[model samples]
Target: MHKLDTKLIQLCKKGNEVAQMQVYDKYAQAMFTIACRYLINEEDAKDAMQEGFLKAFVNMDSYKPDATFGAWLKRIIINQCLDVLKKRKIEFSNDEVENLKVVDDDNWDFDNSISKQNILNAIEQLNEKHKIVVQLYLVEGYDHEEISEILEIPIKTSRTHLRRGKLKLQELLKVKYNEARY
Candidate 1:
């Protein structure tokens, strides 16, 4: 990653075409996959992926290897996807947004029959804030404090979003399964 860290940035900054392609080749599929996870649409995913890369390339000089290049690039793609969703005006209300607490609930059945893809699809259906808070908490395994800092929200807000997101996801999974059975 370090080899790519320096070489890619140096070539990109120098306006090297091959280096640009190299950057695209290495990260496009991965970044696109992540974007697709958010957008749940191939074309929109591609748009976000493209924009993220363009941003990353243009700002390549600002990257430091203190973190993996892939991690940095992935953040860009996620932010791009989030931006698209935000533009759609899907958001949470104040009442729903007020509560933010994370107590381990013994009732969550991780052993349930819900297929991973179904769960992922349900997550994709969430509004941008809920979708991202869910992803950061459950998928990425980030703690509330980390999530709060990352998302620029209060700790309580992070907890609230996570709680609401999980409850919604469970409801979504139940509905989809029941519909399928019928």
Candidate 2:
């Protein structure tokens, strides 16, 4: 953390409203974008971001300097978005994956023709559980252990979802690739 950021966080911990606003201003837009990834509705995204900020403020004492402040806030925003999804009854499966043959393919190398936007759109087509796992792993750069902790699922379940989601995403992109070639 920068000296200035550390000072600002200390002020925030002391309940300084101006410092809090400054911190919120610095991170709100980026946090809102993060929330939007999990929430399709702009209103829901905004709500999640605001609620996340509130949670951070309430839990300001727990804000350690182990990670950058933005990363910490991002985690809070993601958790808030997931809480909203849980309220909507989105089931994150806790199924045992002992028998599932999960391929450990870290190869996300899509064809040259597949635009990043195209891949993102295909991710949206995934089932809720798989989509969340894929986004956390691929987009947010979380390892399966971190993902499992965040989603409260087993490490195997996270890998299984990522594998299944990756396969489905490839299948979707292949159709697009074929259409474009025709």
For candidate 2, the 10 contiguous residues with the lowest summed lDDT are 96-105
The true-versus-predicted C-alpha distance at residue 60 of model 2, in Å, is 1.6
What TM-score would every model get versus the actual structure?
0.77, 0.92
Task: Give the clashing residue pairs of candidate 2, or none.
Answer: none
Model 1 stretches with alpha carbons more than 4 Å out: 2-5, 96-101, 105-109, 112-115, 125-128, 149-152, 172-182
What is the TM-score (0 to 1) of candidate 1? 0.77
Q: Identify the runs in model 2 with alpha carbons over 4 angstroms from their true place.
A: 94-96
Q: How many clashes in each candidate? A: 1, 0
Evaluate all candidate structures by whole-model CA lDDT and list the values in order: 0.78, 0.92
Query: Can you write out model 1's per-residue Cα lDDT over 34-144, one digit (the tens) per residue?
Result: 887778779999999999998987888887878888888888888788778768865544355543455563345643667888888888888677888888777666788
The alpha-carbon deviation from the true structure for residue 126 of candidate 1, after best TM-score superposition, in angstroms, is 3.8
What's the lDDT for candidate 2? Answer: 0.92
